[model samples]
Target: MKKILVVCTSGLGTSLAMRLSIERFIRERNLKVKVEHADMGSANFIEADLIIGAKQVISCLSKQNDIETIGLEDIVRRRYIEEQLLNCDTIQTWLKEKEGLR
Candidate 1:
C-alpha cells in the first residue's frame, strides 16, 4: 500500500482534518493507500509515497524529488481534493492499477 503523509504547521487540528478527508476519499474509491499526519517539521523525515497539505506546506515538501506531493488551496474541501487528486498522474496511475487488480 502507498503511504500518504498529511502535514500542517503544528501537526494538530488542520493536519488531522486533512487526513480525515484523504481517508474518506481513499475509502470511497477503494484506493489502497495508507494515510498519516505530521507537522511541517516532521514531514521531511517521514517516509511517505505522497505528501499532501496546503500549497505553502507542500512547496517545501516538493523539494524532495522522491515523494509525490499534492498541494490544496483549501484543506477541507472534499470536492477540490477529489478533483485535484483525480488530475494527479500518480493517483491516476494508482487508480488504473487498482482497477486492474479487480
Candidate 2:
C-alpha cells in the first residue's frame, strides 16, 4: 500500500477533508493506500511515501528526507476537494516517472 502524509497549519480542517477525499478516490478505483495527517509544526512522528501540504508549508518540508510533495494551493480552489485529488494523481505520476528513471 502507498503511504501518504498530509500536513496543514493545524492538521484539522483541510487535512482531514483532504484525507477523506483521497481515501474515497482511491477506494473507488480499488487502489491500495494509507493516508495520515500531521500538523506542519510537528511532522516528525510520521513517515510517508509522499508528503503533501499547503504552499505555505511546502518550503519547510522540501528539504526533509527526500519525500515528494504536492502543493495544496496549486490544486485547491473554490472549495473543491476533487481538484486536490486530481493533483495527487499528477504527483503519483511524477513519482512513477522518477522511479522509472532510476
Candidate 3:
C-alpha cells in the first residue's frame, strides 16, 4: 500500500475534505493506499511515500527526503474539492514511474 500525506493551511477543513475524497477515489478504483492529513507546520510527523499540497506549502515540504511533492496548482480546480483529489492520480502515476512500478 502507498502512504500519502495531504497538507493544507489549516489541516482541518480543506485538507480533511481532500483526504476523504482521495480515500473515496482509491476505494472506487480498488487501489491500495493510505492517506493522512496534516497542517503545513506539522509536516515532520508525517511519514508518507508522497506529499500533496497547495503550491503555497509545497516549497516548505519539497526539501524533505524520501518523499515526493505534488503542488496543488497542477491539480486544483475552481473551488471544487473533488478536482483536487482527482489530480492525485497524476501524482500516483509519477510515483509509479519513479519507483519503476509502472
Best-matching candidate per lDDT = 1
TM-score, candidate number 1: 0.92
lDDT of each: 0.87, 0.68, 0.70
Per-residue lDDT, model 2, residue 1, is 55
Residues 1-99 of candidate 1 have per-residue lDDT tens digits of 688889999999999998888898899999889999999998888888878899998877637666778889998888998898889877888899999
| Tens-digit lDDT track of model 3 for 5-91 | 889877887777777766776666555678899998897677787777777778776487756677676433434544554565655
Cα distance off (Å), candidate 2, residue 61: 2.3
Instruction: Supply the global lDDT for candidate 2.
Output: 0.68
User: Residue 16 of model 1: what lDDT?
Assistant: 97
Stretches > 4 Å off in candidate 1: none
- Point out the worst 10-residue segment of candidate 1 by lDDT: 59-68
Candidate 3: which stretches are off by over 4 Å? 74-102
Output the lDDT of residue 37, model 3.
Answer: 92
How far residue 19's Cα lies from its native spot in candidate 1, in Å, is 0.8
Please give the clash total of every predicted structure, in order.
0, 0, 0
Q: In angstroms, how far off is 102's CA in candidate 1?
A: 2.1
Model 3 TM-score (2 dp): 0.68
